[model samples]
Target chain A: MTHNPTIVVGIKQVPDDDEVRIDPDTGRLDRSSAPAVLNSPDRNALEAALGVRDDVGGQVIAMTMGPPPAADVLKEAVAMGCDDGVLISDIAFGGSDTWPTSLTLARTAEYLDADIVVCGEETTDSSTGQVPPGIAAHRGWAQLTYVEELEPLPEANQLAARRDVEGGYERVVADLPVVVAVAFGENEPRPAGLHRKIYAENEFEPVTVDANDLDIDEETVGLEASPTNVGGMETIEGVDRERTVVDDVDELAEAIRSTEVFA
Target chain B: MTDIDPSEYSDVWVFVEDHDGDVMSVSWELLNEAKTLVEETGEELVALVIGEDVDGVVEEAIARGADRVLVADDGVFEPYRADPYGEQFRAMVEERKPSIVLIGGTHTGRDFAGRVAVPTHAGLTADCTEIDVAEDGVLQARRPAFGGNVLATIICEEHRPQMATIRPGVFEAAPPENDRDGEIERVDVVVEEADTLTEVLERSTGETADVTEADRIVAAGGGIDGDLEPIRRLADALGAEIAASRHAVDEGWVDGSRQIGQTGKTVRPELYVAVGISGAVQHLEGMNDSEVVVAINNDPNAPIFDHADYGIVGDLFEVCPELADALEGAEQPEVTL
Candidate 1:
């Protein structure tokens, strides 16, 4: 079961949580006036690295850091069949967080020798689940995190998975150069096959890397060594309930026996 | 030079929890938060409490302010399982060194604090909603991430006894005072059935007797998938407590123990309707610390209307039966536990 195992995942284009656009002069979030996609929990972490490359037989790729219009989510992750794709982007990895965007995805997943990385337990535009455990604590590896289910114990090269505990759920096993983070309902991503969308519009070619290309360390990752200090932004507003817009289910069950909204 | 030196540490443990022998109100809210860091650093707040008859839970953690309880007991530390209560609380934190420990994120503190932080490499934050102590003594903690839309604060700073956990209603419980005064002291954990690596076998019992004490909480989301019959007719017109949202348990529509957020179950009832939830941030990190959040949702920019104390925007199929007929014509308080 180990012929194609190259797997990588990690996508992130963002700003299409149904078309984001709030910049009234820099409250930010204008993502160039909306529409960008490929960030629904990193397309459920690239459908869990294409379901661990369709059950332990791999080759999934898909990577991205952003800019150059985030290479259109790497041509939608090579039309969802990913065999390769990379983009680290320049401007010195802009305002990075989740610790230097996890040290630029751990120096591009240790210059792509990655055996399993997958991510997305957070980031619909910096929702911040802390970059897949800060990219498995800067690639020292062995980080499981919230994943939903992953199997393939490859007779102990390890992979068991499950994880979502707090009030129930946990299995854990890990092993092969780990780091997971999954969980966005773990798997819905698929549509994009049309002959791999015409070989991702001309056999895509990314591979960009920067920050003097990976030999890293410009005073601790970025924004002058991030230790997280975002102390502001407060909008929690919903509490005005008082309505009656109905029609039927027997007047919606006689309007729920008569507006007790749940006594 | 706040680099921690409170005499390099001595005692402050806490973990008591119990369960089959009873006593879990988050073990007196971690002994009312380790009696405020053992009265600002004179240290010695100990509790430990593993189980098996546990002498009425070490005289209820020494009447409820534990200056010392310890216990451990045995019979392979009875039913609390999770590798002999995290190896008898990591053998009383390596023979009582304790500079601070606290554990109460429950489900037996994340199964004995994730197997006692994988053999005490230490630094075990887990749930924490808040926990202070840094004048350089450390342990800041403060969790909530992405689903609660960021609050992080952590700090293990060269780990040792800094641990954290903290979830049941995020702190606020120390006020019993039976003329205060304490000390229980039992401590004999020599349990060697090969240190019981998990084998509770069977204990069942959970058909919703404690959705964190529901007083009324209809909740539903991912826009109530395939008709939960108007959320079971608004939880039978407001007798409430149905709850959902981790997108209606990822669209199966419900049951993941009626999922809520930041990994579920943390309701604070008295009324919390929510129907078509759009309040992500880990479902407003478990009902935005619930108290009275209504939110119906048709998406008037739904972040669960920013924290919903009562938002309606409409369309939960005609405002959940007109808010279940305006809460069946209002007037019905006094339902207490």
Candidate 2:
């Protein structure tokens, strides 16, 4: 039997932004106590990858690079139907920006011989949406971004995608080894199967791969190699308006009735 | 470590993008921003155009703001393949380095800008809403982060040609200054036949409402309680465009193009009426620049009132109809938004 297509889905563990609070004294996000959750859109990416596998009888691989605690998201992805999960974690990869992050993911996809790679359009924390394009650039592979729909043609070694652009959406067909960036709320994320969920939490211990596991040079994949620096953050304060309450519709109507805007 | 001396980089460059001979508006907006910026830095602003027979775009770029226009006209540039386009700009960036490079955050812009940034390592920032030069001469890009909960200003001080993808409608576009003098330089495009590139098969375009240009907007939000006709009636009565918050759009009550928020569109309409909108931070990021804002909601503490010029705390269903009638009968009231 021929080997099945290997689709590697990239996921991220970001701070639960809803639970995040600002350190009013420092004017910075207090992520220290916040819990980490699988990025919302990333779940859609995983669902897309798994859906492809369901149709083509292939395997879906969940991959992520973060601290040790990040392995939890991998477990969640595996529980969601991925056949395997790989976590690339190391102190050397710390402080890496999108460029180096893309390098690391590209190398992992290369080693895995991925036929297709998928990622959320952006992360909630950084929300740059550059890593996927960076990966496509680093790998010199065709990149389909902001994809809302995916059609897997396993026999043809191509994936047809419907992506959004300026005025409208277009259907694009790209050769295999392509990177697909899924748009937010593209698909309804499926629930993890009951059988998978039974063993997902207990049986999953992601295969950990450190920097040495790959052939990439250390100099090219760390903070030192990153070009952009987070210099400072200035908050864009929301507007504070007068909370006026008009007793009757006529009073409010009369008040706004003479304004040049509506009349 | 090899460092690029700040002194070597001289000009502010913008990618002049044209798709199927239709020039993108973001290019003009960026050129306007560049014009304002270059005046501050005393640097020449250049527009780099890549396409075949792009003489019209060349003249347009010059009229817009560019002190100089560089055109790379060749057959390979047709239909826009990523490899050749990215390499051509990368080569130019490496040869005649600029202090800053602004690319429109369009479909093609994101594709090539991301690729162009790799080897150049230009410290690319995506979806930047604001770009400016810091006191230290570094390019500062301010963008939304943490799901629009906060804004972060990023700096790429060490890299030459600090690159950024600017979302459209974030900056206002002005008409071309025809009286200005500018020069056009032609450059040959180099494409490798051996490189594999994705080809476009069939192309089609669809029209969406442009709320950014709407002088008056009547936007609905989740507070409408599924009855949009009242708001629609008000919008019809006022001859205003209908816009919505992300909530209404996501809830399938309106088209996504009409959504006004950080993730949607950045708009600065003349008059904006927010009905049933709770005034989320994300929604405010898009239309906070409106000349006048009026919010109507039953909840007095709704955040929408914070930015509104006038607030009416009452049920929208009851208030919208009355306001529509009052507006229709006020003959010759010097109507404006």
Candidate 3:
């Protein structure tokens, strides 16, 4: 039997869309006001990993990093068929950008000895596609970004993953001990099994780790060490819409035809 | 006004992106831009070419805009691999003490810029849309952030050499300054074969779309649903290339390479026609610099109209075909690539 490589997926709990509110004063996303939920793309990533687990018969683990409230995303990941879940939650992790976040995750991933590490291309709130690349940098691991599909290559201890390129997909055969930044549509995230959901909800009591646990220098993982910093933010005011209602498709067609914009 | 002393830094360097014998277009673009900056500041525009046949590449750099091209050619530098490239770049910067290092925001550029910036302890602004010297003589690099909704100007005050990745197509290529003369200085690129960490062994370049050379673009957004045959038809009608937002590509209605946004290509077509796109900040950042923008979406409140020269709020399926038909009669414009 082929060796079933261990897989690990990282998830983030974000504010559900309904609860996502803009801070009128700052125009930044109001994380405090929004109710936290599992990151949707991360769920898709978990599904991709689980699909690999099912096909190849391997162990799948999920990990998360956030404040105390981030444990909820771990439970949700476990409920989605992951055999185990780990949460790295601490106050020190607050205000961390992609660099430190990836550093912490790299430490956790190294601890897990995972052959494959999967994560969403970006977080719902930050939305900067930096974590996967940064993690690869921290661990010196090969990164297969914008992964749309994955096929197992057991013989080479590698997987053939397709990354979305400018005009076509770049099929890369990445050796194991790799990090993948998965985008949506690679697979439709499977619904959490009833028994797994029940088990995850009741049995999950998340384990947290602090700065002391990981052997890392503090300057590299926080706002101070971040390469990019948010200068400031302003709320986007809703545009004043001048509605030109067309009663029929002809009027719309005529308007589009007459427009000299593209001309 | 805190004026940066020119004497503080010694040289002006352009990061040359070349593989095998062919130099990337962005390298020439950066040299052209860097030449302008150096000329304006009365500094020498130097090229740091690291690869095989360094002399020929350096001559090419001087032909484009470099005042002096530094050549560090060897077998290890044959391909623009990340580790050696970063090490070489950082070493040159430390040795020569360049005021600013400009890199093209290509795949290899990003890889080298990310690693070199960290080790060199220099500030790096990625995918910068604009680069300028402030009145104080500080290098000001402007880039879109928060999904291109807002533009931020970054500066490196503490660091010696200011670094930035200039996005392709952001600047136009100017003719070479033939009157100016430059020199090529070859250096030792002495890394043993055993020291090489990663081998290119083989590389398969993706089929070229040449979307950047397209005069016109038909970009689809979240508004378009179902089959994309209609969009393709419109693209065919205008001889325009097809592009998409992240949403459309994520839907699997289109390939990822056609994606235009933060994580995708930055296009500056002569005419950009957006179909069913809501004009998200991410999408807008990629195409806002287009010469002309026409938006077609059913939602009147779509954000795309803010930068659009003309907007038609309606079903794209209905309006797209009509637009295609209308363009058939209208004289097609020429795009200077």
Candidate 4:
């Protein structure tokens, strides 16, 4: 409806996979032990949002909800040329499943009056990939999932997307005010911009929205409102097969021919 | 947890994906799986088929394992959309309350699952590898996270109809027995266009190879150089579908449609050849069910060897060209899904 599109990207900070350790007692990630880093896929969401803004003028708002340390990712997003950043943080928002998580995000989208909300396909910690669609359903908006590439047509208030589906690729379109789930590696995330970084450090202070800031229904804004619970957790590993490497190409070829897989 | 009684729910239900009378294989697989969950919980097995002319799906579900089949045949259900499809389940869930609902983890099914979860306040788990009944009668849904590094077991402790979209290939479809007796109920469903937000512009889905259904797959990973011609040639020679690990997909060496890993498709092909694959736990999780696996890598200690039945430690640049030459004009086996 405006001259410039309003793109909102929901980013998250997750435990670095390599440095993560599972707490055997609680069967949950030891976040304190593992340093927090941006959820890798969120880069694509930011990239998609920035790309749209670049093609047609727009404001990119990067948002996240976590502890104070999570502010680093919003800074990184700002460094990457987002027009602004917002962090939704509070102790009451911890331990949220997709339900409450989306409630918080949906309210933020409303608070920002975002025309489009972009999200990573899944988070490394939960890997549920439900929050995006949950937000769309709660907001009564269109949703596109696993979108590899998307472009907003400003005049028509429509967005066309290339979606990766079960058996093949599909071209779909949704009206504005839709939620899009961008898969990892959709586009190369641009390196942090020099001007944006200067702005992030000197002139920019991220707007923090807590429970008191928005019209959050207390009954549906915290972990207490989530429908799912972690009953238990266990580590799963692949079975190890014995190794016998062939020395030469000829031997490898011979082995391949005789192998049951080929037969 | 809420004070809701577990007795309020009565059966284990599955969403049967019936597109113009053609039932997707995964729905049948889920029906078979729901049979197992029903046994553990001592509940009835039911199947929900929504679409016009889906009588074949309903009958087949009854034959396979469903004690009851709810069929919603309406013209509005012709095109599958999340909002309408979600409402069909939400209305039924409100009336007939099933303890658990299983769906195939397809893009359409998962999006629909998410919408339904909100309306019914059901806890939804996507891409679940396994599911069962807990000792306390709660649904135990387990899924791999962080590239298969850990398994998280989740439960809908406060919700009804603990829902999960099970990975398609985890369970085999049960053989249908026409003689099996079952009950069928016809549902009345109506939808307003305003209730749905989006429509598919152009659907080009049937052409691409669904790696999950490919009997033989040749997968490439990060160890492979930018050149994928060699791997493509090898796959062509063997009449196998091409699959890629996350690394290969991320590197643009292959398409993500065929990626095999925790974040991609879970495959159970009969023969899998991993060329230049280091076998990240994520990659291994997708194809560990293959009947046989052959690994070709230069690194002797590459993690792929741990899951491969045959290991060949050699430079793929040399081995691939040589292997291509050796197998040149060789007979390509005929495989079927």
Candidate 5:
């Protein structure tokens, strides 16, 4: 491995989950109800990458695949101390599921000769922590998912991470060039610095790449190639609650005591 | 990508996850769910068990409902590395070509399902809460998206082996029948340690109780103001496990294991007590199945009241301790009885 490894962090712009709403009548998503923001966990991934770069002397590049406005997340990443940003956007890439999404990201990683690829555990909208592993599978690289702590051993060209497993956690060491899915809420992402934010806002322009530039086969890189399809969507109706409002703490306690849960 | 003919697929395979020779309950739950799908599709229900010393797990899987069991017992599979386990599973999938593959949406399942799916060109859906077989034999996988507000039904029309990871606790496990008979076939493990790139160095199990298995839970939220003493007292009085929402966990007021929400564990307890927790849709997704929900919050307009069977508008600091004392006093007669 080179002394100065290149680390690429995958960023995504997702609708604010807290504010997103579903139209009661149409049973469809009202995306306009929520403003777009950088996916929360992705910031943790970028933080992990920035930490690794600081520890081992590497360049952190933020990459995102979305519409044109998606580049804003890259700018946010730059303001957070990333060296560069790449936007892989194209009409063909739209509607691509995790399979093609990861493939396209893998192609971009390879193009940049990234020594490590970092991503969030999952997105808020889809919440499928598959892209990181999918990227590793596409490149046949080792991966660490649900990673809570990351340690870079540049001397050995390996990255060690503590990953969350069912019932427990395990520390795993993988060779450098590993893909890492940083666990949500693992670390507090640092706020963007003032000078960096100014530069990112006023002067920064992410290098844009399309499907054509990545040598992507039109038949294999878009919705036509994506296997999963949304057959239909149904708005979940809220269950009718008894709505028994108790006046005081004692009354609340008596109400709970009267329930079958005590028995 | 190789052209796939969906007609070539036949059986429904459920990947049975093993935790130290004990089969996870979700695997059994998936088996029970798969039985219905197979019944509808006229396909065999197969269980794929991959781990070392999983003979007991294989028998249990058969008794629970599997028509056939495929075993890949190997030392390399003990620690559950994605590369080897995924490679082995991918090999079996390629050779057998099951129509529908159901995996438990555990950390391990989500980690490797894509690894196998991407290589095989199979369509994989993640964390499906509902699944059924379409008339044409396609698997309809429905999952809550955008924080559980809308449920989307997904399908793979052209994929040979449709894949989905079902969230645990969404389905009930069928009672096991020891007398039930099923075919058990051993699969060859071709993956070697040298072929794997990652190595597990250390592991530590959590000491916290599993909230998902708790019959009754007393969970606190951001309104707790970083103090859990009152909630703990209430939980003790109610004899329930203590849990928290994502806000409490993120604020370091509680352990992450005790967090219940979209990104956290899904719990279906019989009784859930929410103290100072505003019910966000994300939080509701995790606890919606609770048989009885009680909310105590200062804000009357808090969304938690909408989902609560009983609501008390008051300060938790004052309400929790008084409720604890009252419940303790009420339980005195039961002890005498």
Candidate 6:
């Protein structure tokens, strides 16, 4: 029998990008202004993990690290066909930057005995694309980032992925226990089934782990442990355009030509 | 690891990314920017080049204003497997202890820097659009966050080697100084094949050009209705690159690399022409920096018109072909006295 790799896919609840706004006075993101939803790419990551599980017989677990409200994403993951969900949440994990956040997730993955960890290419809110590789680095595991496709070589105990590069794509094969960062929009996430949605909404409760549960040093898992600090923030001022209304395509083309763009 | 004294670190190091034996322009751009930081900090400007047979890259780094160049020329780093490259970089950080490390925010650089920063406990800022040195020799990395709505300046106050990944094309590359001299040192490659868990099996180049580097871009949106021929013709007439909004990319009308938005690549082209795009806030966030924007949409109420310098209300199918013809006619030789 082929080895069933235990896969843990990381998901996050992020503010809807279209609605996200920054407070002009404080230069800080106004989280309350936007409604929270499952990050789009994380949905793809979960879909990727589910696809892997369906191909080979294995358990697909959804994992997330955020505040209490982050559990919604986990329940949503369960509704989408994950076997179980794990939420690493605590007040201490709040204000944690990518470094500590990644460390905590790495420890949680270890605790879960995950053979594969999948993450979105980046969270829409931060768009850092740091956590996936950071998790791998913390645990000394291989990573395949910006992956668009994945094939499980169950017999070889490895996963092969097609990942995006600057101007092209490359195919890579990694040993088990690798972190895969799924590219955004690469796959169509399946809709929640009626039965699964009903069960998830009423009966599903994700396993919650805190800093203490993961044995993470308190000093290394919060804002105090984060190395990068926001020195300041400023809103980008929108430029006032000429807003010249042109009559026809010829006039528009003439206006474009008048600009020094081609020069 | 965080206990290291900040005073112990010295010099500004820029990682020179090598792509298929050629050094990426972003590397030299970083070296140029690092020159100013080194002058303020009273430290040397160093370039870190890691790849197979990187002698040519080393020479370019020195010519581009590197006071010293560190090389890890080995086959193990040929295709940039994260494990070996990260290990080698982490080992160097522990030994040499540079004050600041700047890497190009490319796919390879982002992957390598994120992995190395965790083990080294370095503070890494991503996709920095601007970088400067403070009076105390601290590196101030400023980057856009919250979908380019706000720019955040980040700093590593206590960290020894402050690190940042700079977006390409944000800075200019300095002119080469052929007579410039610099010291070259070899980095000890401690990573072996056994240490690498990932192996690159194959690579295939795509046809789409990098829109981020283009001076002029004609981008289509969902209103194009899955047809790119009109967009391509307009781009060809204008001598511009073809790009698309996230909507068009999701519809499979264009390659993902050609996408521009909050989730896609941020671009600051000289001239941006939006065709049939409604200009969602996310899409505008990516191209708002363009010097001039021209929007063509059937709806005058399209939000894209708010950000555009010029707006034309029409069907893209009609406007595109006409505009292409008009631009082509305008390209004819002018009568001169």
List the candidate 2 regions with Cα displacement exceeding 4 Å. Answer: A1-3, A24-28, A258-263, B1-6, B75-81, B147-150, B192-194, B222-231, B249-256, B297-302, B312-322, B330-337
In every candidate, what fraction of the native interface contacts is reproduced? Answer: 0.02, 0.51, 0.09, 0.67, 0.78, 0.80
| Candidate 3 structure quality by residue, lDDT tens digits, B1-337 | 1233445785568888876666667788888887668766778888888888766677778888888888888877865555566567667776777888888876556656655664455556677877887555568887765445456776666455777788776676556655667887876664565643344433445544545557789988877885687688778777789989988978878766567776566788777888888887767777866766777888888777776766777778877786677656555555564
For all the candidates, what are their Cα RMSDs to the real structure? Answer: 21.0, 3.0, 4.9, 3.1, 2.4, 2.8
Model 2, span B246-330: residue lDDT tens: 7887676877668787667777876688999998777888888787788989898887877887778888998899788767764
Q: Where is model 4 more than 4 Å wrong at Cα?
A: A21-33, A254-263, B1-4, B18-22, B208-210, B213-215, B223-227, B236-239, B250-257, B299-301, B324-337
* Model 3 score (lDDT): 0.71
Query: For candidate 5 chain B, which ten residues in a row score worst on lDDT?
Result: B328-337
Q: Provide the lowest-lDDT 10-residue window in model 5 chain A.
A: A18-27
Per-residue C-alpha lDDT of model 6 across residues B44-150, encoded as one tens digit per residue: 99999999988888898899999999999888998878999899998899999999999998788888888889988889999898899999888999988877767
| Candidate 2, TM-score of its B chain | 0.84
Residue B249 displacement (Å), model 6: 4.1
Model 2 lDDT tens row, A1-263: 01378999999999887788878897766887889999888988998888888778778899999988898999899888999999998788988988889989998988888888999977877767788878888887888887888888766778888876655667777877889889887788889888898787877778888788867778877888788877767777765544455666666556555565544
- Top candidate, metric TM-score: 5
lDDT of 1 by residue, B240-334 (tens): 77878777776666656667667555677766777887876667777665656667778788766667645657678876775566556545555
Q: Which stretches of candidate 1 lie over 4 Å from their true place?
A: A1-118, A122-263, B1-214, B224-244, B248-262, B268-316, B319-323, B326-330, B335-337
lDDT string for model 4 (A1-263, tens) is 35488889999998887787668796665767888899999999999999989888879999999888789999999999898999999888887888888888988998999988999988987777888888888887888888989977778788889887655567777877899999777789999989888888888888999977977766665678887877776766556654566677666567667766556
Off by over 4 Å in 6: A21-29, B206-213, B249-252, B256-268, B332-337
Q: After superposition, how far is residue B57 of candidate 4 from its true place, in Å?
A: 3.0
TM-score of chain A of each: 0.30, 0.93, 0.89, 0.89, 0.96, 0.94
Which candidate do you rate higher for DockQ, 3 or 6?
6
Interface RMSD of 6: 2.1
TM-score for model 5?
0.96
Q: Which lDDT tens digits does candidate 6 get at residues A38-156?
A: 99989889989999988997899999988878899988999999999999988888788899999999999999999999999899888889999999999999999989899999889
